[model samples]
Target: MNKKRLSEVIPLWKADKRNYVKKSTFSTYVLLVENHLLPYFGENYDVQEMDVQNFVLEKLENGLSQKTVKDILIVLKMILKFGAKNKWITYESFDIQYPTSRKSHQIEVLSRTHQKKVMSYIQEHFTFRNLGVYICLCSGMRIGEICALTWEDIDTDNGIINIRKTIQRIYVIEDGERKTELLIDTPKTKNSIREIPMSRDLLRMLKPFKKIVNPAFYVLTNDSKPTEPRTYRSYYKNLMRFLEIPDIKFHGLRHSFATRCIESKCDYKTVSVLLGHSNISTTLNLYVHPNLEQKKKAIDQMFKALK
Candidate 1:
């Protein structure tokens, strides 16, 4: 039996894995290995379960979230399996445990009054850049999706916006110097490629400009050049500050849209589809949070049913 060090086998495994996954995914795996896994396990070909458990604990203690640690572990497992398949190493699966009680964090969303105030402000004092935020509030589009949208993606006749691509600046290491590149690609998931119908108000606001704007120009920039997510996020932050609105992450616009739909008694399946969530459970877990009134209503219904 031949044994190879993890450091020696990982490069070969990465070369083989590169052809199978998306460039972004491949980059993520490379990053995880280089940043987390290889540094710890590079010398060991036959990694022990206890070693991995300790790694997880140490990472958590260092302030890495459970999801981030899990992602690192996924890349680690993949490399281990690759080495095993080629007889460079042997494999053993390990079960990991985490704290049963997790800190519950509520999703932040704008209040209805604040939402209305922002919408009204945008309607009265509108710009092509501000329109992206308006659309996110109404349609639940992500920052990347809004940044990538072209005028052609909006069909006024159909009143739907086709979500096809997303723009992100990705990290890369070139010649041992780190640089970033702008990548315009399909969205993060297949489900993210979807069409959302525009609200009547949104459609009305967009109609006059659509006639004069170039079809290929990005919506946010209203020019051939595109605005990236980081820039747009800063723009939103400044806008909120200028308006004296409470600060929230750019993603909260998406959360606000989904929460409004759920609050209005929109069905779970439709809300899930509109938000481009991969599955209904994600929609339920995030947006189906029952308020006090809802819990009280449920109890009242149960008592009435007994009568």
Candidate 2:
């Protein structure tokens, strides 16, 4: 082996990685390396399985989500593998263990009444920003996607909202100086680039504006400059507070939309496609819990069939 510390090998690995991934993806990898990996293992040449397991435990104890810690491990493994391939360090595979938690994560969503109330309020007093929230409720578009949407992407004639791009602020480290930049990029996954038909009401609301709005302007701002997700999130939070609605994360809008669709007995595959999920299983997992009534009805139906 060339006997180089991990810090020495990281730059080489990053330079090679930059060519293969999207800018947003590369930024995410850089963050994982700088914030989680470097301080713990920067000077080390060889990281053992025990070291990684302990790191997983430490990160969990420090309140990182299991998913987040797993993401960090993936980045670490990739960097290590790259270093080993370059003969800069010896690579050993790591098998890390996580303590299984008994608690199930509950997805937050607005109650049907609250959803209607919010929608009604937005309809009664419409602004471009409020319109974004209404559109998310109707179409299940993510905040980033909605923020990046331009008037040109909305097909008023066809009553479809074309989802093509997403915007977020990403942290970047260049020449050892850390800074943030607003990045407008393609949706995270290819499946996320899709077309969602607008609700008839939504189409009617949008038609008049579409005729007058600048095609290049962002839908949320109705201007050339786009608002990034963070700022949009703050506006959403304040709107909820002002309306005396319980605060759920902004993503709850998307979840609320999906929940409504499932409740309406929309097919799982169609819901998944409309929500831009990579697969139907994701939609089912998120929104398909059976209530006690549903469970009892299913059992009754099964008994009747047997009889």
Candidate 3:
């Protein structure tokens, strides 16, 4: 087989890859490769399963989440597959195992009281920027999606928020120099391009703006220029601090919305669709947890049915 270092093959793979994926997705792949994979295995001419297993363990030790580690591995495999296709290296399949932890991972969400307090605060003192947060809480839209939204996408007459696009700043590496660019693209998956019915309050809040605001301008900025996720996240953090609410990551807003839906006994499939999840299982895994009371009630109902 032809022997070549992985570093040598990466450029060729990336050149071929750039044509096939979205710019933001390609940037993500490049970042994962540069930050995680290249440093570990760039100079090596061959990669073995054991090497990958060791790398996984090291990444885990470095506090990378299991999902992030797996994402890095996926990029690794793609580059290797491309190299193999070009006859530059022999690619072998890796079956890596992760250490199972006894600790249960809990999803972060704002408590119901805090959620209501934040929503109430936004409604009482409404700015266009703050309205974005209110929209996310009511419709379960992601930060990127909400940032990319425009007045045109909000149909107050129908009370529907069209979730068609997302915006983020992506890091791009070219000629060994790294730069970031704001990218506005369609949602990552087809499922994410959806329609969410607005709550009555959300519809009322947006109706006045819909008549006066520029249809092409971004919702958050109320201008032709869109605010990037990083900037919006910073604003969210400061807002939480000012309101004396315990800070959670920005994604906690979406989680909080989904958790509220589940708590309301909304159907799992409906919640999944509203959240734009690819499948219902993802929604269930993240939000469906039966408390002791619910478990006891379920058991009682089963015995009653038998009797």
Candidate 4:
């Protein structure tokens, strides 16, 4: 792409500070240059105002979402600023704004009866993966954190479990079906790296499970390697189907946990901590929170006392 007409300074400048960036950031920068920037303006291309306008229009029409277009434009602006500073090109003000973002979607929470029925189904039928489902129901652990759980993190004597990491997998569409790739990652947020106290029942259930051999991780295969996220998801889905449960995203269990917490008068701060939320605001804003029934009950109690 060093073939276009305007200036050769960009590649040189990019190569110069390659050492300053961290590996992941540098990799992303390389990808941006190779995959996005270069194709539009090979080396030696002059970017006139009209050319910039035309490119912006093309970007919008190309099915890039507004957020993505905004990001691309930000990258462009940085490159142009770099070019101007190094004396490669003259500058004009470029306005970069985005179309409004999509509104937040509503969260779905299972009603108490459905939650009880699902638990009963799992308990009576599927014994092995029940811990996986139960933790999501009780603590709202992300599937990744649930999958990453290890025997070492379980403090059976103290009735607490340390959440240290998570397993994440991304699926890229290769042919028609998606191909999966796995990566072990830090908990989604720093707050997610936390400790959850086990209920007495949970502690009792896990006692015999602790005798299982684990060379390193808590949840492992026969060979002691980690459980793959996709595999866990498949197992979870199949278990739900076998139980004859209505199909809800596995994440709904987390919502049910949080909702039940509120209904039980578990304080928001405690619920926030239990859920490993980075901030209480995230817990309040995202969780399908208290509804009118809870509020009406409190008002009714106050009036009954007045009589």
Clashing pairs in 2: none
lDDT of 3 by residue, 35-120 (tens): 98999999988899999999999999999999999999999999999999888988999899999988898989999899989999
Off by over 4 Å in 2: none
Top model number, lDDT: 2
TM-score for model 3? 0.96
- TM-score versus the correct structure, for each prediction: 0.97, 0.97, 0.96, 0.67
Write the residue-wise lDDT of candidate 1 on 228-303 in tens digits: 9999999999999999999999999999999999989999999999999999999999988888998999999999
**Cα lDDT listed for each candidate:** 0.92, 0.94, 0.93, 0.70
**Residue 202 accuracy (lDDT) in model 4:** 70
Query: Which of 1 and 4 is the better model by lDDT?
Result: 1
Stretches of candidate 4 exceeding 4 Å from the true structure: 1-104, 170-181, 215-217, 220-223, 288-290, 293-307
TM-score quality measure for candidate 1: 0.97
Q: After superposition, how far is residue 246 of candidate 3 from its true place, in Å?
A: 1.3
Off by over 4 Å in 1: none
Please report, as a residue range, the 10-residue window in candidate 4 with the lowest summed lDDT.
Answer: 1-10
